[model samples]
Target: MAVPYVKGIMPVMDQRVYVHALLDQFEARYSGAGGQFRYDGQAWFGSDYNKLWLKSEGTVGTDGRFGDGDHEILYDRSISRYFDVQSGVRLDIDHGPTRAWGAIGLQGLVLYFFDAEATFYFSDRGVAGRLTGSYDIFITNRLILQPQAELNFYSNSDPARGVGRGLSDIDTGLRLRYEWHRKIAPYIGITYSNMFDKSMFFRENNGKNNSGVNFTFGIRSWF
Candidate 1:
């Protein structure tokens, strides 16, 4: 009798990678005491439902001095069509001693097409939280308007870093951009930022204005 032949099973291959970046806040402040630069961006790689994500944001003075910055690497899992649950480690690099925190965050698109992110962090110093929201309005195929806001809170004061407990600060801005291409756009806008509660006191003692409106011009791009 002839021996029976068997078929070999093939291994599954379901892998993908993606990269995206944005210069969310790269502009010059016209009314501020000094020029400043800010940036926020992220990149990720993974399969359809799971990914390794890295995010970073920072602010600096034009004199080439670093101010405040945070970096996070997280495992992101898609929980729904519009949201992702992320848990990771966050590192704060600023004027004071570097601190590490456990971070958990939610990122999603909400009703009325708003992009939102909320993250909570805890470290030996204390707990902190950040909330950000933004929306885009289209005026034409190439013209767009964006409004954005961010709020920060802390549980304890850190004099070395000029941070205070409770509600620390809020920043709001509006930008109008003309896209030369889908991946690049130039924008002009105005921003209003203010410190609250003990955070205001810290600014006062440091001879800094508690609030101001600034005119900004910059470019927003992604790839």
Candidate 2:
């Protein structure tokens, strides 16, 4: 029998692409916690300013070793010299809760692109929603920084099985990078977040509040 790669059965493991692994520690009033590692990838096809992109990402909790996966496909069109529009479908693939969501975004050149995403989840756990926004600021020919924010709203949890409290979560973070030409760059940044009424889905995050500084150093480039 041929084993599956995504579910980590056997034989097919060689087909997987390794993307990222990191440990992030947080300090909060009630308890301290750590973040897990993440791996992600994107594939693109199409021509001109119009393209189809498929992306997949997964995370593993550092403490409890819980895992989750996300996959999405986007269709992008360049509307003009200074602006572009994107429409996409997102799928959350984990067993505990799964979701299908839609999003739209706009891009610009001067400061990269500014994007906003709205999500709706389909799960017995709850019908959750979230809003997110992000942008990049170029400091020099080789250096750039991005600050991002997200807010999550939720529907009441199932009285018997749900784990969330139907409140909101707010998260903010920044990323900085130095590019070597258009292909390679090393980066770093920080983030602070607050979990409103619900316990974080990850066991590592037991408390409702978290604040942390992160250092990132990686290489990215076009071949």
RMSD of each: 5.4, 12.3
Q: Among all windows of ten consecutive residues in candidate 2, which has the lowest summed lDDT?
A: 22-31
Model 1, total clashes: 0
TM-score versus the correct structure, for each prediction: 0.88, 0.58
Cα lDDT tens digits for candidate 2, 13-99: 433433322112121111246554444445566655667766565545544432346677778676877655667777767544566
Q: After superposing candidate 1 on the true structure, give the runs of residues whose Cα lies further than 4 Å from its correct spot.
A: 1-15, 207-210
Error of 1 at 31 (Å): 0.4
What shift in Å separates residue 220 of candidate 2 from its native position after superposition?
A: 4.5
TM-score, candidate 2, is: 0.58
Worst 10 residues of 1 by lDDT: 9-18
